[model samples]
Target: MQLKNAALYLLSLSLLALAGAITYFAASLRDINSSLPQIIDTVEKVNQNIAPLVAEAADIKKQIPAILKESEQIRVSINETIKEAEKLNSQLPVALTESKNWRILVPIIVKEAELARETLNSGIQEINLVRQEIPVSITRVESLITESRNIGKETSEGAVAGVFSGALRAPFELIAGIGNSVFSIFKSEEIILDNSDKEMILETVQALINASEFGKTTAWKNPATTRSGEITLVNATTIKKARCFNFLFKFNDQKPHSENVSTILCETEQGSLEVVR
Candidate 1:
């Protein structure tokens, strides 16, 4: 009976040890499973958070070139506008002169035409006599134009040439136009300067000079379509005085026509002239 009781106690002790080992191993396995599932869930949430940011970075990279191209286009357009404005600024003077009411001043021009008529009329007979004897006032006109060209060239090569460099730059520059006008006047047989006409033209010329002093001279040039004139430093008087002079005369059949006259104002360096050509 003693041996059986000892054997039963040993067996009970072995059974309790085995049950304790099994319970410890089961609890450790449960803890490991719970930790693994939590780690997996954390990794999944991290991937979800990073996805939108990655997509946004890719989208910005793709749009960068388009935004840069638009910026370049805007810069180019602004430069073009600036260039156009510069061009317009260069042409504004002539454009403003051409738009004024020149025809309204014609009656005033007619009233002051007598002296110019006499000068041109008296000069006609001389021109006709020369034409009959010489046969070529046109050639003379060409010669005068050539001489003027030489003078202009010489002047342009000197210190005073700087004054005309910009004037020669306009597309419709008046330098060539003035030469053409001189030729046209010489070609006409009916345009002559008589002695009486010369006096009248001179008187009117003086009055016009006076007008240039008190009034503004806009779009007038030396030597109108059929006249001859000059501009000099001597004429650069007070802004209210004559800064330039343009003499004119008329002729019929290469003879002096004392009754007809024409006169005009010319350009000047002064500031007060109304350049209303």
Candidate 2:
């Protein structure tokens, strides 16, 4: 009877342990069931992300032949490059020898270039010097021209005076040939005239003859010497390519003596007026 009681107690404890295990398994299964939708959603997302990778892998697999062909071409190119590298290596000694020749010439070429640069600099300096002197030279040339003009003017005036004196002397010489008395009277008048008075008379004669119209008269008086003169343009005529004019000059001296002279003057080729004998 005691053995049957012990067997019943162990069978009841095993039943309780089996009920606890079933309860724990049911709770675990409920948790697992709760997480199953999220796990399925994550798996769907993984599949979506892996879709492009799967397509790319397929495409890469399809291009495997072309990739192998390109790789073969690359290997051929690499082989050619290596052969060229070997050829270059074989020529390196010659190249180095040529480079040595270039190195020897390089300094010479550089020296020549330096010489050329110096020559250019010298040429530029010369040009600058010429440029600097240009204004001075031009000024000198202008000064020379002005001096020449002044000299020419003075020479022309002197020549005109000389010609006029010669012409007046010729008429007087002709008069002296005719009669010594008339020449003596003219000589006496000249002797009595002051140099300044003669110059004034000559200037007035030139001015009136050059500027006055025919029959126009111009007069001058010097109060200091009581000398007076009147010049009149009477007529104009052409003679052998020269424009000629007839002028009447009247002179009065301090003694109140008066003299009248008729003179013919011509414009010479030199553009100056001189008495015509």
Best by TM-score: 2
Question: Candidate 1, which ten residues in sequence have the lowest lDDT sum?
Answer: 165-174
Q: For residues 1-277, could you state the per-residue lDDT of candidate 2 as single tens digits? A: 9999999999999999999999999999999999999999999999998999999999999999999999999999999999999999999999999999999999999999999999999999999999999999677546544543443455435543343333322221121122221123343444365556666666665555433345788888877788887878786565675656677877777774778878776665554556664
| lDDT per residue as tens, model 1, 1-277 | 9999999999999999999999999999999888998899999999998999999999999999999999899999999999999999988987877756566677778867977888889999788877786647455445544543454476524432332222222111123223333223334455554444344333443343433222232222223333332221222212233233333333333223323233333444432222222
Model 2 scores worst on lDDT over the 10 consecutive residues at 172-181
Residue pairs with backbone atoms closer than 3 Å in model 2 (clashes): none
lDDT, candidate 1, residue 157?
46
Off by over 4 Å in 2: 1-33, 39-203, 206-212
Error of 1 at 246 (Å): 74
